[model samples]
Target: MTTSTTTPLQRWKTFFADRSSVVSGIITLVVVVLTLISYTGFLQAVERRSGVVFVDSIHRILGPIDVTWPTFVVLYASLILALGVLLTRPEHLFRTLRAYSILVGIRVICMALLPLDPPMTTIPLHDPFVALFTSSEHSTLTKDLFFSGHTATLALLALSMPTRSLRIVFILSTTALATFTVLQHVHYTVDVIVAPMAALLAFVLNRGFAAENQ
Candidate 1:
């Protein structure tokens, strides 16, 4: 009998060939898509309501700047890089997706419980990609504050990386993204500060869930 060599392509094919793996991937993707769509609707509704604005000592010190381009640059580039790495490891990709979906659900709950208006010195963030899905009037959202979604997303990506080098790179990228969000005043200091903690909670929960299934 001749032995067969396992290549990267063969491994990927084998992964997809497993019915359980395929089902899990489909479920995760559906959950993520639904979570995102729900978040968009919630954001638009929250934008219509008014909330209290408070003073943040940190925001007072740094003030607001228009760092929109730089913010998206780091955010999207890091996401692309993380996806490139995670795709090679299909399991990691699924883990990241589940964690991210959990993160968004957490954010929605927190935002619902604590409605917040943007900072008094807020420089509105303009995301071109998000604009595509929203109406012109609802394009710039300011009330989805509690925790920073941008920061949490990058933090989740960092935690989900399968390698030390990738983790380090994502950690730095997350830090930069957090700084950019705060500098832009698109999020309050507390928002960015709590983001990593929220992300960690999601990551830990996802890991536990996966472990139980295993």
Candidate 2:
């Protein structure tokens, strides 16, 4: 037998070139770039506008107590971990990206059509990601809060994972994230509640594209 130096990832990649991961990957890249652009633009546009206030029931019930200890850090960490899992498999990552394009496109529309200020009691989430594109450190990017991106993103990954076990685990993470987002009052009750449906729709539409690509 020949000396085995090739890694397992190389074997997997070699087996699937015929399945058109190359095309899927290219589309995913394009979509990822576009999504980032649109997301940044949306945030900038929203930042320019005055926030419209809504009386959020969850914020009223929870009273924006500023629980930054475990709830805040743990929820943000879960989003990072969910993304890491999605990147573990090429096929899974590509399909999830395709779905994400749909999810993000819908989100952009929702944010544009439903532009509203954060709840008066909304806890500020000075996210590091938002800071990347912000014009100034003094400016707070808090107005782009129509639906919950964190909840929707984790929901998309949960719905689009390749394996049953991975999907189950991802869903659990999504549930945890949804709970924390609600409890933290970072998102309105309706915002987080409606996000998973949007994500599921995105995944359903992208499945057809994924099937055709493979």
**Whose TM-score is greatest here?**
1
Clashing residue pair totals per candidate (backbone < 3 A): 0, 1
Q: For model 1, state the Cα shift of residue 16 in Å.
A: 1.2
Model 2 Cα shift for residue 181 (angstroms): 2.1
Q: For candidate 2, lDDT tens digit of each residue in 1-214? A: 1114544476456637655557657867987997888777777887777756777766677756565455546556666765676555555667777788888888889988887877766677666655776667424566767688878888887787656886787788778777767666777888888999999889988887656645
Q: Per-residue CA lDDT of candidate 1, range 140-170, in tens?
A: 7778899998899899998988778989999
Candidate 2 off by > 4 Å: 1-12, 69-72, 137-139, 212-214
Which portions of model 1 show Cα errors greater than 4 Å? 1-8
Best by lDDT: 1
Reference-based TM-score of each model: 0.93, 0.83
Please, what is the whole-model Cα lDDT of each candidate in the order they appear?
0.87, 0.73
